[model samples]
Target: MKGFGLKVTETGAKSYIYQYRIGGRGSPTRRYTIGQHGSPWTPTTARTEAERLARLVGQGFDVVAQRQENERKSVSLAMPAYVEAFITNYLTTQWKDEADGAATLRKHVVPVLKSKSFPSLTRSDITAVIDKIPAGQMATRRKVFAILRKMIRWGIGRGDMPQQDNPLVGFEAPPAPASRDRTLTDGELVLAWNAADDLGYPFGPMVRLLIALGQRREETSAMEWNELDAASGVWTIPAAKSKNGKAHIVPLNDVALAVIDGLAGCADSAKSANSANSARRWPKRGLLFSTTGKTPASGYSKAKARLDKLMVDAEAKRAKETGDSAELIDAWRLHDLRRTMATGLQRLGVRFEVTEAVLNHVGGSKAGVAGVYQRHDWKEEKRDALQAWGRFLEQLAAGEPEQSNVVHLAARG
Candidate 1:
């Protein structure tokens, strides 16, 4: 009776309680309610389990510690849950303020890792996922590894799992190959401008504005009528619309001003021909460039397709007359125009800071230091830079400068 003892307690109409006492002098008896006497675990199962527990305890074994150890091993085996908890708690909530960082992880990281358990995930598994991504996306892969490391660290902090000691810690994908810097040559600019003019579509003026002002396609596409100062010949791009999150002042050269004037004329013409209600319905959010059906243009895919066709036609015509391959003079992209403007400025002997400021490149000295200290808007310098660029464009258009060269001023000049 030393290792085994039991006591019966209350009977609530039909219920009964049982108790057990461990062996020894001062040890107190412990009560364990075995269900209603008639039910399963009846007297038989309870007695069997209790006796087993007593024997294990007598051997210096801790049942509670054993159960906990089993549980720890089970949890260690559940890899999928750890990955899910890490992504939900850390990636979504903890790093929520990193702009689109959370979205990128959810889209790219979660799907692949959701079914994979932590212990099973190897360095090769990570590398395999990264390799499937196009080589051009090496930067994106590097960023993804950082997010994964953060997620694993978060799991360790919660005490639900051990540290992953991230296998991807020092892994680096090869640098993405550099793409061709396809800034337009002077002759190409002339062909594109002429083709745009001949097409005589809404994109014509927009293309002119892009070339003259060197604004990003999205910035120009989202431009509002209110942002334009026709009298002062300036177009103000708001900070939110700008890539650097800073407002920019672009001096509207004569060509850019003319394009805006033409747009205004077209809007007035639409108003005159329609009923008052119809005229009011005309998208007057003051968008300078809009879709053909009067809504603001949201994307450039359709427009680019049309532009590409026009360039193809022009190239074919040139090829037939001169016996040159059409591929030699094909369509250029809208982005290339910005590069053309930058290269054009560089060729005009414009200062590097001035050129970078015009392009809104953030890494330049003027972007960081002078952007703060030289608080004076450098309005004249900007005007001079744009005017020089415009004149160079005109010379190119006129076919005066057959070859493009960076113009440098001599000390005597």
Candidate 2:
């Protein structure tokens, strides 16, 4: 054959040759010299040699082809490929509504694990990443463990990851979450409420609402006018927004309503400034307390820092008159307000079940089997409890400390 060649000239010489494309059909063809015939290569040997080359070509294992396949396999097997797939496919469909879950992955999990292989990922690898998160951030540590549990379970479910080989498979995995019981005292509540006023407008009202409503930070911060019924004094938190995955009707008292009204005044004032031209431009719908009405209130960290400073200044002023330093107010988080509300409700003699209902909790009498049977909305009782609690809060916040639930003993006796 000319290609598997035998070339005989005046000085007879014979040789073998091969020609093929590196990448199939449209690729430029390449030719390679095999061996000469008549010296080491006879016609039979040349034919045998050509047969071996044909086998290699058919099996797709020529040097160039093998190299390309190896590169493809390397890329397919890479960790980044799996991470991208998991976030794109799993997180979007399954965890789409979970903002905090998504944030945890982006902030803590994804950064450390984006390029890490599932098979090679070890316990130490997970632990090291967690340890890098600043200590005392137990909540964040717990969240990381939660994300790992979900991601590892997701991988194992998908069948590529073997359960026995799973790095996250363990008896004692996530550390027990730290319990919080810090309730601001009535006097401290008043001090904090006043300080919140100095913080001003959205943050001030936000902090007050945190104390007044006992709703979660995310729910209150993202409050929309649509969620509130001004006429009925009801704020309907839809199942989509609620933590318990249940629709909750929270009855706002006068104090809570007034805070919202103040926010409305600000918005109306902004509209009135350019009502003719900017009527459409002003966001009249979305958030009750946002600079741009399309979004929810943010700047919590900075706003809280300012509120803390105001508390410190107030404490110093009190100490200046008293000559004894009134205990400097302890550093408190905004969440403490919710706890204070729960505790305060009990002090005001709000019934236990009603209190839990106000908090929209599923625990206590509402948990497990009881939750299945107890379908009652407790709407009237919840409304009463919130109204009663709201009234008690107004008394304290209005600087009437002399009238707290104290009884004169000796005179009555």
**Number of the top TM-score candidate:** 2
Global local distance difference test of model 2: 0.71
lDDT of 2 by residue, 1-413 (tens): 42366555577765666666656878776555566766678778877776777677767656445657856755644556765566777776676234455556667865776666665677887887688787777777877787777877887888766888877767355566578888898878877877877888789888978887899888888777778765566789878778887888998765576566566653322221112443222223688667776556666778999998988888788889889767757777898898899998898888888888999988998999998998888888888887777667766655554546533110111
Structural similarity to truth (TM-score) of each candidate: 0.53, 0.71
What TM-score number comes out for model 1?
0.53
Clash statistics: count for each candidate:
1, 0
Q: What is the lDDT of residue 52 in candidate 2?
A: 74
Candidate 1 residue lDDT tens string, 327-404:
665455788899889888888899887887787777767555666776666566877898777667666655566435
Compared with the true structure, all predictions reach lDDT values of 0.63, 0.71
Shift in Å, residue 153, candidate 2: 2.6
Model 2 scores worst on lDDT over the 10 consecutive residues at: 266-275
